[model samples]
Target: MRTPAQNAHLALLLEVAGTPKPGNVDRHRDLEDLRFEHFLAGAVGAQRGLEQAANGGAVGPAFERSVEGMAAQGGGNTQFGALLLLVPLVRAAADDLSQPVVEAICEDTTVADAAGFYRAFDHVDVFVGEPPAEMEPLDVRRGSDAVPALEERGLTLLDIMEQSVPGDDVAREWVRGFERSFVAAERLAEADGPLTERAAAVFLSLLAERPDTLVATRSGEAVAQEVTERAAELVERNALETDRKIVERFADELVERGVNPGTTADITAAGLFIALERGAITV
Candidate 1:
């Protein structure tokens, strides 16, 4: 039996190993600043913190440690959001793999967990949208500098995620009992073929289902919607199974345009972890 930490590590590897992930780095694709090998290195480096989470460490600290380790590689922020989801999920898996279990783990987060989450930003470059005028003082870009404000507000990690939920899909997952991750796990379980291929197909399904927030942040909301529309069309045609070149072409176009559906990739990683722990996906 594989440990949750081991499965988490494998989830990272498999996510990146799934080819043609549309603008994201994968076995057959790489962005200018990110590469396939960097992701591989990141997965290896993230093992320590993953183990900590599996050992029942606090979510914030384990997540910060994971980001620190992931950043030890040349790739910057290869799996920050993914680890944000994985730490809590790994902790939940240590006990039980259910929505309520994970939700409780997230809701149990403390102000210190919020502090550690902010500190993780110190280790790498994560592109986040600007905070609302009222929340500026709590902006993630402030990193540890925002801790005082967070402390004053008595904001826990879950609280922080709730504040961010309107704008960030990953944050939405945290506050919503990881609903999308669980849904994706179901999709993975129902899909056929190699796990890697299932991941790729699921990646497309996710992209088609929602506009990637990273794309909206990097490009624009218009562009993000357009990307989603294109993916939906491809998926409707069953391109992933019947005509892979069509999917690869879309991936190529996105790569050339420098538009990465990073948030979608992060969700895919989280879903893979859930599926692994549930025995829906096995190594």
Candidate 2:
């Protein structure tokens, strides 16, 4: 049986997915793609939440308890519910795109990685004229055999979304309009100069602080040790630096609003998780 919270989350995903919008093809596709990607990332994050909970890792005990309670109630069914809501949105968004984009994605090694490409594609806007005169006619084909499970999973999501948000015409319209203006991927990739430098700087600042908290907050000695090691690896690879500055700035801004700087890690983690839960982040 689905918990009330899980049901509510499914309803929310459906509501967002059904948001209304104008009929422009580009805009409609963009919004649908983004909303779908956001929901998928949320599902991934939720599953990760369960893993982190079971391991008694770095997340707050309160959060772990919540996951435990949810799992106890119905055996992690919410994750499946989330998947049921995600598939139709993916198909609706992808069906209209150019073949090259779809082919490029299908060839990726993992479904998650391919899905990530679609998430990026949602923010890309390019105008390519009809196929070049010198090129042979495009031989596009759906390679369902390549990733049958992923394709089936995506379709299942579509079915769930359809069932949950059947009559919300207004929300659907909004989504259509939002998609038209979406430009996240292009903005992230092509932006130049000091902005990139600043993001790198911010990442480094946060990476420096993460290890201490990972060691202190994790419940199990082994988990703490693992997190500590992971944090070190992140620093060595400069993995967090890209987003560190933005995170720090965001943290500072929150502090200015009366949030305690001493609680920065907890607050940051909470905010990030909330965004994940709410489908604000596409990946």
Candidate 3:
């Protein structure tokens, strides 16, 4: 059996290799600076940290190491959002993959976890919404400079995520007990076809269900909602040829418009990780 950390590694590889994820990086899709190879290296490099998290390690240090590895390869935030979810989920899988256990692990996060979270920011160019003009010292863009403020206030990572939940989906997952991720994992488990195709379906299903927060941040809620509606329509299409045409066309249009449904992609990765851990999908 694959270890939980190894499952994380396989899930990342499967996620990136799942082609035509519609504006997200997949085997067939490559952004200007980020490619499938970078993502592959990132996933492989991150396994050590993810495994450590499964082995009853500290959350902050796990993030620190995983982000460092991802930065060394991708040199940007290729999987930062997914890393946030994977750390907690992998930890939970070690004992039992349930809400209460996961909640406890998240609830037990410390100020050091918050500090490590900020430190991970030091290495990546994560695309995000702009911070307020007058920043809190804890503003993530401040990087390590925010650590001192975290210490002064004794704010745990969970506390910081609670503050950010409204504006950030990843933070919302942490604070909301990963409801969306769990939902997506359920969808994934019931999906048909090859694992990659199942993953692609899950990715689009999630995009259709909600306006991707990353897309909303980049292009406003109106654009995000419109994209989501189009995805939903495509999902309901009866003919495979029509669906393919729609997805292909939308993929081109989204990239052209700089609309990446990255939050959906991250959620899909979390679902895949869960499926892998549960043996619902095998290597």
Candidate number of the best TM-score: 1
TM-score of each: 0.98, 0.20, 0.95
The per-model lDDT (C-alpha) reads 0.92, 0.28, 0.84
Local error of candidate 1 at 254, Å?
A: 0.2
**lDDT minimum window of 10 residues, candidate 3:** 237-246
Model 2: ten consecutive residues of lowest lDDT: 19-28
TM-score for candidate 1, residues paired by index: 0.98
lDDT of 3 at 269: 90
Q: Please give the ranking of all candidate structures by lDDT, highest first, separated by commas.
A: 1, 3, 2
What is candidate 3's local distance difference test score? 0.84
Q: Quote the positional error of residue 161 for candidate 1 in Å.
A: 0.5
lDDT of 1 by residue, 130-225 (tens): 888999999899999999999999999999998887778999999999998998899989999888899999999999999999999889999999
lDDT of 2 by residue, 8-108 (tens): 23333332232111111111222223334443344434443334332432222212222333333221222222221122222222232222332332222
Candidate 1 backbone collisions, by pair? none
Worst 10 residues of 1 by lDDT: 73-82
